[model samples]
Each structure stands twice: as structure tokens, then as C-alpha cells.
Target: MNKLFAFFLAMLLPVVLFAQTPKMGEFTQNEIDLKEISYEPGASAVFLVASGESRFFSNILETNYFYRIKILTEAGKEYADIPIGYFAGSTNVEVVSAIKAQITTYTNGVPEVTTLGKESIFQVDLGNGYKEFRISFPNAQVGSILEFSFKKADKNIEFLDGWSFQRSVPVLFSNYQITMIPQLEYKMIGQGENFYHRSEKSEGNGVYSWTLRDLYSLKGEPYMKNYQDYVDKVEFQLSRYQTAATTSGPEWTDHLNTWEKLGDELIEYYSVRGFYRTNPLEREVLSLDLSKGSQKDKAEIAYYYIRDNFINEGEDLIYTKQTLPQLLKSKKGAPGELMLAYMGILKSQGIECNPVLIGSKGHGRSDIVPFPFLNQFDEILLLVKLDGNLQFLDLSDPLAPFGYVDLDKHVKGGLFLEKNASKLIPIDIRHNSNKLVFSNIKLDTETGDLVIENTIRNYFYEGLASAHLVEILEKNDKPLEELFSEKYDALEIRNVKVDDLLEDKNMYNISFESVLKNAMSEDLIIFNPLQISKFATNPFTQEFRVFPVDFEYAFNETYTANLVIPEGYELDDYPTNESITIPGSPIGFSYSTENLGEIFKITARLEVKNPLIPSSSYGDLKFFMESVSSKLTAPVILKRISIP
Candidate 1:
């Protein structure tokens, strides 16, 4: 892919000039005296001007970057240190020029400039073939203006990092200009919520420029998936190029424009098909007894056999680093390699399975564009047909149950690699993460105390998370009571019993006894019936959200409590029965109460049917969560009755 991108960039090289490029070290009065950005008033720092100019010359692509920032507050002083990074291991890319930085401060309207000296510049190796050039601006302070400029040259033109108009700090003006030849055709993809100005000049060479002004800083919100998915940015992909033709018509070459061709190339270059054909695990597969059970049962045996036998090195890579035989001999490999071995075993037993390439949750959205960009995917899962049903399996997590896909890998779709049938397939898992709680409470009139017995059941992903937490706590020699106490405030817990935690089951159970002190106050008793509250406080604190809220997966939390009212007190006030649902969505919440003679039963369930909620529905979701929190934490009041 890198070579192909480099070739396309080489074809775009021509003598071109950009007149709109900003000159370094120039600052306007408004930028110098800027106190805060009008759009983003709370921003500590603001980018006054950010510009980039790129051109291919002499078989090398050189990009010049200029940035001017104003530090409005003390926290903004951290911007004084800037680190420019590049892949040092790649000979094709390098920092060809020295970095220049200066800090400008005003004293009674008089501008004073301090230039960065060579002593303040240093280099650091960031491991994994990466290195960073650190530049420390001299005498940086609040209300100071910092300016920096550097040139980066890449022999591999595919290293075009494109441009991001918006950042964590507000950007007043962000511009990027690229010079290209007419022979090559490139596809430009722009994303985010911003209007941009685009212009093209053709003076024997093509000069394309993009300019975005006054872009607000994209702030991170609760439950946001990936910042890159919503940040204002532009990317370019080489689509087609014209070749010197010897025949009657000119020839145009397609550069990975189709998913099918990209899949074919991946198989060919990575030797994926070769590994399948060679059956690297044939000997191991033959040793396993497979003729005893049904296809699904056999698949389970094969999955567990590979999962239990092989050690995962904890890397979520798509390709295998070692050969199958080498991995088998070592008994340890990356998740992808082990999955491949599992696939080999399944294939040997005539089971239907294929590798699915996916971009995990933190990797950003997979369907950003229709273009076949291979870099979009960072991990691979197995798509198998068992009992005529499709299931996605990720062996990355050792404790994850069979047919369990990691929550991070629960993307909208994945590229199913099945020879000629390779295509994008939806990832629909029927399982949900749920937590069920049943609490029995008794109020003591004399001592003003409440005794509670709670039983909690966690299913699917929730159970896996609980199991991991249990493992960690047990490793540290901490009692399970600590977990319960930390979770429920103002409660004393005892007699904790955990079941099916380390076992390979879909659900885990935890039962414990707790006492809530001071339930009665003078003539009244106030208590919260819920033993396990999902939301103690509203997660959606921000009034407005620019990005979608990703809950990771659909979840359900049900809390059922039976409170035995004391003989001296009668129920006076309780949370009213109410049901609320987001219109046109599956998200809902309900709280109901029942009076059964002396026993008061409270049932509440919070169901989020859709994990990903769009920003447009954020207000409703926020309101719903606020209501749920209020109802769950609302105290049940009981007034003392005079002796009759």
C-alpha cells in the first residue's frame, strides 16, 4: 500500500507554486492581544494561524508547516513545548530542516521577542520506529504569542498526513495547499461539521487549496467513541493515474479503488490464501477427535482447543508475525495468528469460516467513505457459520466466552474476506450486557437502621468485566466486600459470596448482606430502595454535544427491591410510578411500586436498546438519564404513627 501511494505521488510531481501560503514569524495585532476565542471562550489556548504547503519535487514530497498560537491562561503555557514526530525507521521520511520557534510577549504595548536557541532543541526516541523532535520556546508565559515552523520531507509521497482544520484548541485560520500534476487523479474526502473554502489554480500545474476559518475546538464528551471521527479534517487518496500509452488509446490505472481488488491484493501480498491452502495445522487438526458431535459442537471443541492450548501475545494485529508452524511450536502468538490456526482447524473439519477485518471502536468509524482504504482496519475477527447462523468471534480476551466479540470490536460492519466473496458485512451480535439485582430490605424502628440482602447477576459482557475485576481484586489479596462497599456508598457490607466468576459461563452471581445506618430521623424514615444503582449521577453533564454518545453496547439494568415496612411507620411518600421512552428509539426507563400488605416492592429497569445515540438525540437521552438518576436516588419517606 505504501509503495502504491508513493508511486501515485511521484506521478503528481511538477513545477508548481502557491501564492496564498502564509509567511512565518508574521502576527497581527488581534492575534498578539487575543485574550480568548469568541467561539470557544473557555479555551486556554487558541491557534491564531495554522498553514501547510506541500509540493513534490525531485522525487520527494516536502511539506512546510507554520503555526501561531496565543496562550490566554497559565494552563496554555504547556504549549511552549512542541513535539514533532515521524517514523524514523522509514528511510522515505525525515525532518529535513531545523525547527524554528519564537515567543512574543507584550510589555505595556511594546512587543518583545525571544527566539529559541539550539540548546532548547532535542530529540527523543519514542520506540516502535518513531522519533520526536522537541522544541521548547524561550520565555513562554501566559498572554504570550508562540510561533513555530518546520519542513518535513518524505521520499514516499504517500506520507501525506493531509490536514486537520480543527483541534483541541480553537483555530482562527487553518489552510492547506497542495501542488500536483495533471496526470494523476486523487480523491479528496472532507469530514466534520464546518464550512470550508476551496480554490484551484491551474498555471501549467494544478494547485489546490483548502481554507477553514474560525473552527471551534472539538471538546471530548462522555461516551464519545473517537475524536478523529468528528474532528474537522481532510484526507486524499490516489484513485487513478494516466500511464504513457503505446497503443491507440491512453491507459489509466486504477489504484485500489475497489474493495474486491484490495482484498485480492491483501491475500496475495500477505500470503493469507497461501496459509489457508497449505493447512499449516493439519497435523494438529488430525490429532483431535472430531467425528463425535454435531458441527456446532465440533466447532466449540476446536475453538476451545485452540484457545486453551495457545497463548495469546496480546497484540490485535491483522497479519501474523510468525509462520503457523513456528507459532504452534512456540505455543504463543498474536490473536490474529491464533485465530488463523483455529480457522485452519475448522476448515479441516469442513466448517465454514472466514476472516473479517474491522476497525475497533477506538480506531474510529469504519464506514467513513466508500473508498477501499486498507488503513481503516487495524484488527481482524473470525466470521463463522454455525448451525446455519453467522457468529463473530474474537479470541483476544482469554476469559471471553465462546462466540464472544470484544465490545471494542462491535463495529457497524467488517470486511469479510472469503476469496471472491469478500465484501462488507454487518456485525450484528444478539447478546447484550445486562445486570440484574434483587434486594431484600427490613427497616428497624428502634435502632433506626436498615438490614439488606442483595443478590446481583451479571450476564454476557457485564459478567466478563466482573470476572476481570474479581481476578484483579483477588490478585491483590483484597476481600470482595471492598468491591461492594466502594460501589455502594454509606453502606456496611458482609458475608460476600461470588459464584461462576472464574467459571466459563455467560453469567456471574454475587450475593451479599449490607446495613444502611440511620434510616430513621425523629418522626420520619428516609431510604433509597435500590441496592445497586446504575447511575449515581447524570453522565451527560454537558448541555450540548457535538458527537454521538457511544454506550459501547446495548445494556439493561434491572433493580428489584422488597422493603418490609416497620409496624410503627407507614409509607408516606415514594417515587411515583412513571415510564419514559425516547420517541422513535428503543431507549426507555420505568419505575413502578406495589403495596402488598406490609411489604413494599419497588421495580425499576433502565434499558438502552441502541448503544450508539446520535448527537441530535443527545438532549433527550440526557434528560432521560437525569430523570432516571433522580428517581433511583430519590428517598422513600415514611412518617411515624402515634401509638393507637
Candidate 2:
């Protein structure tokens, strides 16, 4: 190996290096061998390479201790149950103890990693400029029998292989559910990119094609209000990636020092001598009291002003120097500028309006503390106080009518105030307007794995939300198909109940239950994970995930899921049904499970109680959320049915 390889390989060989691989576990490939990464469309490819098949095993180790490839096969290519290791290593699959964290990367948002287990590490000689290595995981805990499928498409591997790669496990996970099977990510592009991705399943199409977190174990326990304490713990561990200070944010002690020392450099904008006055249009909005003008007349007047006075522009132009005056003079503009100009006209006519600021999904979060991280604000909305109620207007998000926000723009925390102000305080508001409720479940089984299904309907938020997810899973929540093969062999899903049908608020409700056959025949089940997540079983789940959850008004929703047990199984225990009220708003959970019909009956009531939870109540609000989440994972055991 060269000096560069010798240097990095040596540096990264201690954590889980195991001799030939890098211990740091860089989540993605450090270098790309153009020749190795290639693909062909509509061509046949055997992605399920047989075990002990090639020299790739050793080369993979040399690169980092991790090597995984995703082949884009022609669509409709059929394959069999890939022979992944029954367990990860040389021995009978390591079982529960085998799949724990050995090493990890990441300390914050964007990505995270959780190593379930590691199998045999075999180093091999890759012919040509390539080398390889192989490591397997029994992966007995993955969704739906651990089927890592390769999508067959009419694309070529000639860097048909050319695709994005992340640093997480090699599995397919979409926006909501992880897609182990090839559900199709990129299809015929160009004409179809926009049209095809319109489905909810496709929202996370490309998102779930790979792993969620990188190999570096870089992700942290989900966000909690005690983010500082969590960050301290993460920084203490993980020798590879280290956590840094948050500058002037709440977590830091001497935030000002850290701010000036580590924050982004500010650019000075000095006024030039050529500054000119704004040439604004003389337009006025007359919101003739509904009592004053006919509904048709009011709508006609609004439509005319929108059509004749505003110059339509694209998303990019909306953020440029297209000031209100510029758009007003042209009597035309994009969403932001147009809204500003529109509000200006309305204000001129004394209609009264304000600009609402929100942080888009990927723009980080909007917690308006003293320090200003303008980058966090990625979206804007027009708010008008009419009859003491604020009307949400997102001219940028075209389909959001005039009273509601686009799904992506509807976040939990943001600032809304009269436009001409620098200081910001909390403002009371409502958004999305959909309510949500779910049930608690306890599955008593003879084995560790089984198929699970839950159906959902969209009523309030679902009807008003403009998201591909709400659209596809709109009529029905995605079909449930999670059954770990190694853990359990057979399973079934039944009673997919859904109601409250609608076309506009497209309201629907679904009720379903899961039946699992456990692998262990012991009189007692060790641990049953009703929901799968890294901390799905952790007791401190509540303390770790405290970010305000935005159900965004789903309309007083309610859900009841019941689990039917086998004849021999009986409920040994259940979480006591209890409800805790959060002050300032209606939000909490109520649940109970009892032995009924040779099966366990559990009804977990997850109610938003109300649409909006004030930030002042954030403390109790977070605690309540965690309490319910924790209750959801409360376990129950199945005793062997035997009598003298």
C-alpha cells in the first residue's frame, strides 16, 4: 500500500479494525474506482453474488472494514432469497448478544449509525487495481426477513452505477418505512421525475434505497431538550468523530466567545453612493367586508388584483432583489415577493397583515433565541389577522390554497409578527389543522419475529396537507410486512380497518392488528419490541426525543390497535393505563392492555387532545410525549400453557 493508505489505514485500524480494516468506519467510500462502479440499463446482472465468490472480500477490508455495493438491475429482474449469513460471524448467528454496537460515527443531525453486529471478516485479493473483504450480519432483526433487494431497471451499469452513496448500512429505507425489497427509486427520468415521485411511497423512494446512518455511528439518540447533555455523552465516546460546541446557542456556557471564535464570518454590506428610492406601484386591496360586498364580487376583486397587479416569478427569483417595490412596480412577482406586495397593498388599504417565518425541513430548525442563524429560516408565509384568526398563505407553495401551508413548510416552532420588526417573541398560531391518535400494542408470541400491519386514513391534516406521503398513503397507510425470518418463520396480518372517507379532506381511518409467532418456545418471552428503532426498547426514550412533534391539526383523530395472541399464550403483564395532561394545550396519551380471547387486547390512545401546544408548556409537553412513547414499548410475556 502507498503512504496515504498506510497512514489512514493505520489511523483507523483500532476501533473495530479486526486486523485488516479501518476501525474509524468511514460511512462512505473514501475513493471511487471509476472502473469498479459501473452499470448498464436493461442488462441482466447477478447482484446476489454467491458467498466466497470473489477477491472483493479482502479489498473491502483494506479500504475501511466495510464494503457494500448496490447494483441497478433491469426492472422486473427476479431473484431468490439471497444467502446472507445466517448469523454475522463464523459461529451459529450470534443471536441477540451478537448485534450490539461495536463502533459508531456521527454526533448530530443529518445522519447516525447503529451497528447491530458483525460477522466473519475475511480479507481477499481483488484482481486488477481492486481488492476486497467480506463481513456478514445474521440481521435477524431487520424488517421483513432481511430481504435486501436490487432493483432491476432498463439502465446500464456504465456508471449506470453512477449514483449517490451514504455512510449507513446497505439497506433500503424510505421516508416513513424502510423498503428492504426493491420498490423502485429512479425510473425513467426527465419527463417522469416530477410526475412519478408524486406518490407517497415514492417521497422516500431514493431516500430508503440505502442505509439510514453511516458506518461511523455518527448519529445521536434522537433530539431531546437536554440536547446539551446528550451531546456531552456522544462527544465523550466515539474516538473517530467528535462533537463540537454550539457557539452562541443555549448549550454553550460562554456562548459569545465560542460564537465569535467559531461561527460563520459575517460579511459587511456597506451602502453605495448609487442607492436609489423604490418605485412602488399604487395598488390597494379592498377586503370589502363580506357584509359589504357579494362573495363573488370579493373573490373577483381579489382574483383581478392577483392576476393583473402581480408579476409571477419562480422560487429562485422570489428570494433575489425582487423587492416589494420592484414587484409592485411591475405589478407582478413570485410567492414571497408577491405576498409581500399583496400584503403591502392590503396594508395600504388598511386590511392588516403580517409575514410569518418558518424553517423548511432541511434548513435545520427554527428556535428563535437571541442569536440569529438566518440560514435556518428557509420558508415564508403571509398571515392576515381577520376576525382574530390568522390565515396562512404560502404563495410559494402553489397548491396550499390561501388558508393553509404546504406540508414541508408546516413546522412545529416558528416566529410570526408584524413585518417591520427586528426583535421576535413567541406568537400563538395554528397550522395543518389535522389531529392524530394511535394505540399501544403488546404481542405475545412463540418467537421473536412476526408480520405486522397497521392501516391509516387521512381526515383533517391528511386532507389539507400537500405531501406525496399524505397523498399515496392518503387513502391507505403503506402495507405492513415486517417479519424477521431468522427469528420467526411464518406470520399473518388481519383486520385492516379504515373509515372517514373524503375526497378533499380525503379522510379515512384504518384499524389493524399483528400476529407474531416467536422462535423461542420458552415459557417466557425475553423481550418483545412492538416498534423497531435503535432506542425502541430504551427506558429513557422519553428524555431523548423531546423535539416538538407537529401533528398539525389532523382533526381530533383516534386510533385503536389490538393484538390477538395464540391459544397457548396469555398476557403475563401490561402497562397500567394512565393519562397525563400537559398544561396550556390538549395533548397526552391513554392506553391499556388486557387478556382477551386467547390473545392480548391492547388499546393505546395517542391523542393530540388539541392542535397547538404552547412553547411555555414545552417542558410538560415533552415529558408527556415521552411518557406515551415509553408506554408504547412496555413489554408483556407469554407463559407456557401446561397443567397436571
Candidate 3:
């Protein structure tokens, strides 16, 4: 009860209460000042151990919002000491000071980490004279807690509204989670601002925290402006690691000199480390008979091979180019490696195969720049020259029919990656050489409703549906559901069957039937949507998108829709029965409706006689689509029958 003791106890009480608010704490005794210093080269398992690690798993995404990343090793060395590469280009925006380190570790072990919880794994502002932040970690285990936010204060630039963060280096995680806190006070400026994780009070200066706990909704990242910038910056900054001189120039003058030197060094290093080998079998194991098989046939075979053996490595490295032989026989490979292997194998078989760079569905284009970032193209696939047309083959997609690459990876804007050279040029792979046959709809004048049936068969349709059927379903069901709703209000889809005729051929048969509530209604409620089958808005319409229109395989389609209308309603008008075909364009749209006693039978078809619409002729292709879309909307008018 003495005054001296009482004072000490009062001070202790405030200390306990202040710490209870969950202010972030330092895991290490020392911290690096961010303003004074920006990066750490390598990372220590011990350092991250103190910070914690995450091993979270997800079937849908390869990365997460938990944007915390660190380097684990240096060129062939156990990085016990954390180096600068471990923290290069890493910046953080502060979030809510927690009463406790909110951490979630996916697993535990010395080198194994998948957790994402704890304040130790994050960078925090360590009070100094100037603006500065610091973070330190020990040899971490999996499932470490992490929190990060984007801030204009931290970086010179303000937050971009549509900006999204992606992995600088591609990685396959067991799971991914990210907690992003928005500073509404600093409103992001741009289109799609409505998107970015915002709080309930969307239009204010509020600090709200959100986390990508599962990353279930994110599309696999394509190329990003900042992500590419980061990569370019990193590549440039780390020129000491790669051949920097190769950064510019049409072709490196004796460039392989550095590549060759590196190759020789790698050969020697691998020899010492027991990782080097020359496999004759690798060069010869897989062979493509491209010269002989029809493009469709080649597509079919590749589709089946990839679908069945798609080793779900997720974003993990399956087989590097150096390990092609092992991957060929193992029947497991990276998306790119597998694609190249198929090309090589086909080449061995006398197939005219080429490696084509794909920009994917999300972003990037095939535009050229002197110091262009290779990340512009995140996907690689094979293209075969058959007879004269070019075929886009995603050998990584087994479910994709011979003719189609899924829409995500189906961006047709690609350049070729050739050996000992980088001669970039546009590749035009399209939907042509195929046709569709339609059977029309008939209405019964007795009832106010009508029944219809249509069958869709693709001679060759390949893309997103075939390959990412699972991924699409796993990622977002709303888009698919919405697409169906938009197509038909009273539609019933059935017998959705996809087929592969042989190891090298593919086909699909879909029978859909629908009944409209007011086919005979006075208002033009009936929207006869000759449905186009793709998850994405065939964004390839003629006017907006200038890229070549890509159709999987040229195929013929036949649709039969027989409709029975109500007694009071009958087919009053039919689309001016007409059909048109354009020269050099593979697609044709045609439809006609007829009236008989109490029945209206209608038939229509849109066929692609070939794939690979050339860019030089993109305008014609767009016009063809605009015309088809226009004609498809022109419907047979259903007039109400007057009572006698």
C-alpha cells in the first residue's frame, strides 16, 4: 500500500491494456528500416520460421491475396542467411492493429510451410525519424499469419482501382489466402472501381479489411501491368543472375555466348550435383505425325492424350524444358513443357509443328516492343500446318476436342518462340471449314405456349469447355447459370454429350428443348437466341475486338426445333428466309421457319467451314458475325389467333 509500490502497479496496468489492443509486435530483436532500405536478398528458413509459413491448399487457384512472399535460397545454396532477393519489390500497406497476431499455418516443418497467420510474417512501420517499415522472421514453419494492404503513402503512386496483384514468380501452393484492407479515404481512380474489395460503406474514407481466405473466385492470373513491371524490374535488377545484355536487341550478337556459357556452366554444375543428363529417348520418345493427319484428327489425338494424363500439378512446375525427356515418358508435364513436347514429338513424326505464345483470356496482347516482357504471354501451345490452314493445339488440355482450345487459353493473339531466335509474328487460328444445319420451331394455335427442340453438333469445336470444364465449374457457377438464363427463359438443356470419335477425332451432340410462356403474347417477348456455346461472352464479336475470330474445328451443325403453340396463337411471321456466305470467311449463318396445320417447324444452322481466320481479313469475319447475330435475332412473329 506504499506510494512507491502503488505507482509501479498503476504503470503495469496501462501496459497490459495497451498491448491488449493487438498492436503488431516484433518477432525479432532487430528490424530493417524500410525507407532506409527496401529489400533483402535471400531468406532463411530459420528467419521465416520465426515469422511462420503457410501451406494452405485450394484446387482452384495457384496464388492468393496473402501477398507475403520471400526467397528461400540462392543459386544452389541453402539460404540460411536471408538475402535481398527474398524481399525485393515487396511493399506493404498497414492494416488494423490486432490484439493478437491473427495467423493460420497450413502445415509444420523445417522446409515445408503453408500457413498464413501471425504478425511476424509481415512488414510493419518501425517508428523512425523518416517514413520506414521493417519485418523479420525466423526459420518459419507452415501456416504463418500474414497481413498486408496497398497504400499510396507507402509507395509514390496512389492505389489503382482495377489493379490486381499476382505472383511475380509462378508458384503452386497447397492453398492461398489474402487479407486486403482498403483505404476508402484514398479512393481508387479508374473503371471497374466498383470491383476491388470494398467495405459496406463503399463511397467513403473508411479502412476496411478483406481477405481472399480461399482464392476460390479468382481467375488464374494472366499478365498484369504491375506484375509485368515487377518482373521486368526484377529481371533487370537481377541481371547479374540472367544474361542482362540479352535484355535488348533484335538478336543477341553471339547471345548464346552468354546462354551457351550459362548452359555450359549449368551442364557442369548439374554434372556435379547429379542433375545433368542427356537422354536420346527424350529427343525421340514423343513424335507427331503432323504431315499426314488432318488438322482435326491431330487435334483429337492430342486432346485425348492431354485430358487423360493431365497431372494436376496446379501451378507447380511439372517438367522444365531441360527435363522434357523425363516428362514425356512420365506422362506428366508443365502446361508449356507438355505443349512443346507434343510439338517436338509431332515434328519427329514429320508433323509441321510450331510453338506459339498465347496471351490467355485475362490480359496481354501480341504487340511487340524492343524490350518486351516475355510474361506478356503466359501460355504456350502447338500449332500445326495441315494442307494449308493453321491449327491451334493446347496439348495440355485432354478434355478439349481436337479443334478447340478453351476460351481462357484460347486468345489467338500469339507469336512464335523459335529456336536460337525470337522472330515474333501474328498467328491466325480460327473457326471455319465447318457448317451448321438447323431444324426450325413450330407453334400450335390452340395454346399460348410453344415447344421447341434443337440439336448442336460440332465437327470440330475446341476451347474452354473441353479443358477447364472442371475448373470453370469449380470457380464460378453463376456465370454459367447466368449464360443459360440469358439464352432461354423457358429452356431445358439435356443430353449434353461431348465425344471423341477416335484417338484423333472429336465430336459433340447436344439436344436442347424449351417452351416459351407467351409465344403468342402481343409483346415481342420471344428472343429466339440461337445459343453460342462458350462460357465467355464470345467477346469476339466483329466490331469491338479486332483480333482474328477463332473457331475450334470447322464443323457442320444441324438443329431441329419443333414447336407446338397455343390454340389462340400461330406463326404469323418467319424470319425473311435467307442464307448468306462470305468469301474467305469460314462461318455461315442461315435460318428459316415454316407454318403448317397447327404446327410451326423451324430449322437453322451456323457453320464454320474452317478455323484460322486471317487477321488481314478480320473485318470480313466481324461483319459475318454481326450479320449472323443480327439474323439470329430476326424471329418468326407469333400472332394471336382471333376467336371466331
Best by lDDT: 1
lDDT of candidate 3 vs native?
A: 0.39
RMSD of each: 3.5, 21.4, 18.8
Q: Give the range where candidate 2 is weakest over 10 consecutive residues by summed lDDT.
A: 230-239
Error of 1 at 434 (Å): 2.6
Per-residue lDDT of candidate 3, residues 1-644 (tens digit): 23432333233221110001112322232121111111322212112211111111111101111223323323212321121211113342322222222222233222233322443434433343223323334443322433232222112111212222222222212121111212111222211211233211221222222211111111222112112211100011001111112346322112112323433442343234322223222325544333446655664565565557646244412225445456666776666666655555555445566665556644433233322234345666566776576776775544554555554565435555444443455655555333243434555446744555555544444323432443465477533333245566455443333333423444443345555654555543354645543311233342322123444356555455555554555556666677877785466767676666666666667676765465456666556656666666555565656642
Ranking by lDDT: 1, 3, 2
- Model 2 / residue 37 / CA error / Å: 35
Candidate 3 — which residues are off by over 4 angstroms?
Answer: 1-303, 310-312, 316-322, 325-330, 340-365, 370-377, 383-393, 402-422, 433-439, 443-449, 462-486, 491-507, 517-644
Q: Model 1, 400-471: lDDT tens per residue? A: 768887777877787888666678888877775799999998976677778788998999888888888888
lDDT of each: 0.76, 0.37, 0.39
For every model shown, what is its TM-score relative to the native structure?
0.90, 0.35, 0.43
Tell me the deviation in Å of residue 519 in model 2: 16
- Candidate 2, residue 253: Cα displacement in angstroms equals 33
- Which scores better on lDDT, 2 or 3? 3
Poorest 10 consecutive residues by lDDT, candidate 3: 232-241
How would you order the candidates by TM-score, starting with the best? Answer: 1, 3, 2
Question: Which digits, one per residue and each the tens of the lDDT, describe model 2 over residues 1-644?
Answer: 23443343334333222122222223333221111212222222212111010011111211111222322232212221122121223331111111122222223323234343334333344434233333333322211111121111211111111111211212221111121112111222111111123323232422222112211111233332222211101000001211122466322112121222212221011001111113322325232342345333343344345645455666622143554455555665556566555555445434445555566544433333234334335556656655455556555543333344555565555545432243333443453344343444454343444335555544544544424333455457553222122222233555644454543354545445555556344676533434422222333333322223344453443445455564555656666777666765476556665666755665655556555444345667666666766775666665656521
